[model samples]
Target: MADPVPALVATGVAHTFGETRALDGVSLTVGARERVALLGRNGSGKTTLLRVASTQLRPDAGRVEVAGADVVGQPDVVRRHLGVVFQSPALDPALTAREALRLQAALVRIDRAEVAGRVADALADAGLADRAGDRVGTFSGGMVRRLDLARGLLHRPTLALLDEPTTGLDVLARDAFWAALDRRRADGAQVVATHAMDEAARCDRVVIVDAGRVVADGTPDALTSALGPDALWLDTDDADALAATLRGEGHDARAVVDRVLVVSPSARDLVAPFYARPDVRALSIQPPTLADVFAAVVGGRGGR
Candidate 1:
């Protein structure tokens, strides 16, 4: 038997804004029921890629398939399989939560008879039932995002494209947002674009983009396990002596402030002997972190 069709497929996708190459031959896939997080710096092409896959913007090159429908030639069919929540706020300020949801259902061509029920269920799922009649303009940032997500799900699309969905949410609101997302895990596949590592940690896999190319892609544990920029740290008043001693011991060690950092693959072998020293104040091993992976892959500029 042939392999089943993937939930989403983008191959050699490329796009440009004037001379700036927004997406350059990028490719990705999300399997059924899988959650993939797209992470990168401020202008690293995450948004452009999402826009292309969601069928909101046509790419200059390559192909995208959403639920086995072509994004370029069968855009309407692709829309039937996609629900996107953009980074920017796109809700109308004047419409109440209920009114906005009703409009969304109509826009998505939901049956008129089912629109009311679907809207009610979406709002309730988003925890907006108590404030269904309130204008969206009066809601907090988190509340607005929740309502936006509710509108996205009203049509029951098979693939969800979320771009920075929890960028500015507070702790409690962020938790609520993830709770809503968790409820949909068994129903469809999700492609979440985010900067929060904690959120990425919850995803089944992560794909990091930079300069319009995919720099790294893997599960969090898998990426973290790969040997990289891993460091063995040593703290002591005699930083120079420690560095010299480690070098004499054939370890590539360097001093930063009052500590020596060892980055070689053999750093772990020195742990036992270092702790045996009387002057060794403290020792800690930092496994390769997601940030470290980003830095190593994306030109050493870390964070987000």
Candidate 2:
């Protein structure tokens, strides 16, 4: 049988803003019911790609399809099968929880007869049923985020796009949000843009992007396993310099943020020499992480 259609597809998508190239020839596909994370640091074009897929911003080149509908040519049809949870809270404090959901149902053009039932179900699903009549101003940050998600999914879209949904959420709030999302998105494909390494690790697949290009794509374990069994992190004053020195000596070393990482099957054996350097303040060895994998991909592409 032929392969099933993917929930989302972006082919050679490019978008620019003035002089900034937010997305450049980026292509990705999210399978049915798959949870994929667009992993990248800030300014890496993950969000830009999400906007294009959502039809909020048309690409300067190429095209995006959501559930078989072109985002630019058939935006209304694409929107019907797509839900978006933005990083920013788009709720009004004066409105009650029920009121907010009711408004969302209207915006999505749900049947007027079904609006009431859907709103109640959404409030209950978000764990805000008891607060349905309460004004949004009284809700906590977590509650607001959950409500936003409920609103986005009110129409039961086939694809959900989440843009750093837990950007400013606290540990407990983030956990709660994930728990709620887990229960709701069981049957749909999800494409979430996030900078959190831990969050990317939780997804079924991770697509690492840098400078508006995809550097790597794979399952979390598959990606990290490629770096070997263990990783040695050398905390140094000048990580770039240390990484250069280690690389010159024929080691798989790369600078990752504030640390220089060296990966191998036996990282313990490689630690002694680096630990003795005056600039190396501390050193630790652990299993390879998504961050380490990301750094390796970016480094191979000639980036820090």
For all predicted structures, in order, the TM-scores are: 0.83, 0.91
lDDT of each: 0.84, 0.88
Residue ranges of candidate 1 with Cα displaced over 4 Å = 1-3, 228-266, 270-284, 299-304
Q: Which stretches of candidate 2 lie over 4 Å from their true place?
A: 1-3, 276-281, 299-304
Please give, for residues 1-304, the per-residue lDDT of candidate 1 as tens digits: 8866788999999999998898989999999779999988788999998889888899999999998999999999999888888887678989999999998888889999998899889889999999999999999999999899888877887899999998888999999988998887877899999877888889999999988888889999888776444567788888778878878987766665567666667667778988888878999887767765554466433322
Pairs with steric clashes in candidate 1: none
Best by TM-score: 2
Error of 2 at 123 (Å): 1.2
Q: Looking at model 1, which ten-residue stretch has the lowest summed lDDT?
A: 295-304
